[model samples]
Target: EYPDATATDPTIVPFGPQEGESLSNCSTKFLERIRDWCVNKDALPQTVDVIKLLLVERKKAECRVPTHPPKDESTGDVPRAIVEAQQDEIQFPDEESK
Candidate 1:
């Protein structure tokens, strides 16, 4: 593609490192060049990776098995919102990866 065409390409945005999927299959040289072009390497937010969240959500999405209360044991049913509130997820990179 020509230089003018590349400049107009929507995929060539500035937020390349904003998500893991954006760099998932990228070449090593392309990765390095993107790193070099970073305007603010130190201003990222303190939050979970978008890719990890998407993966967890995707996994949950695939688990389409509808849950039901046991026929013989339950005296009362817990609300879905309360059960969901008790569950949480987090991810942290190991020491060597940073």
Candidate 2:
């Protein structure tokens, strides 16, 4: 279950601007909130997957920036086992049927 809070609760704050904000700013704030939520012990696999996808997309975008320096050609692909291990660290176990 989610945290219990009433409308008058001061600590139950919104993550970002309420109105007239740019889409990019809103998106960034939303991602930050999701990342924080994903740190909880009960986070679902789907939540972790969303964070991973966001990270990979961000890296790809950074690489595509015109003014950014290029990556060195000498670096090679990450080993499959290492990649799997990293995923395991973040991933949740399969959910049981309700």
Candidate 3:
């Protein structure tokens, strides 16, 4: 019965902030923006590169913010170097950015 129930599938949806969860951050929004933009943009690889560069630059720029020190704000966030490495690992279908 359970298998049959799932077999007749209707529309499925992702559960998140819209469904009443505490979801709010730049990273989440950044990923969503990238996904949407890449859908219609040409040269996917170049687009991805631009996104990664923008992300890294943003992090670096924020590091120099005078109001709040980066150390204190990012005590639990991923290390910038690791984040950059992960960005490099990002692979799209065509691998056009290389």
Candidate 4:
């Protein structure tokens, strides 16, 4: 456990201000608060992370056009596997038979 409340010592910047293409691009700082929330089962910071986020900002000049999947021929929109998720299902309530 952290002492002196370093975890929440400084409240994180409001969510709206943190909105940016990347953390480095945001005018506000947020990484410290994010780090505070990460820990292992022993309540200790885990050094061995299975996956890590590496957000880096690139100059607009250096950015390249991203490839996208073909859009639906009829709808002219990108196809989503589900209404909400890449792979998800939408459920409807069953109506009672008369």
Best candidate according to TM-score: 3
> lDDT values of the candidates?
0.36, 0.48, 0.44, 0.33
lDDT per residue, candidate 4, 1-98, as tens digits? 54555356554343312111222323123344445455323433442341132222222312431234356799986644222222222322234521
Note each model's CA RMSD in angstroms: 15.4, 16.5, 14.6, 15.4
RMSD of 4: 15.4
Q: Write the per-residue lDDT of candidate 3 for residues 1-98, one digit (tens) a residue.
A: 23544336532222222211112333465566667667867558878695777567556644543332133254765434333333433322223422
> In model 4, what are the clashing residue pairs, if there are any?
none
Better of 3 and 4 by lDDT: 3
Error of 3 at 29 (Å): 1.2
Q: Which candidate has the highest lDDT of all? A: 2
Q: What is the lDDT of residue 30 in candidate 1?
A: 42
**Which residue pairs collide in model 3, if any?**
45-97
What's the lDDT for residue 29 in model 4? Answer: 37
Q: Please provide, for model 1 over 1-98, each residue's C-alpha lDDT reduced to its tens digit, 9 standing for 90 to 100.
A: 44665468744533322222212222233445444444335423422353454446445533532344223246475543323322321222245643
Error (Å) of candidate 4 at residue 60 is 23
Q: TM-score per candidate, in order? A: 0.19, 0.31, 0.34, 0.21
Across 1-98, the per-residue lDDT of candidate 2 in tens digits comes to 87657366843434322232333444476576676767764577788686676667555644443342333357865433333333323322234611
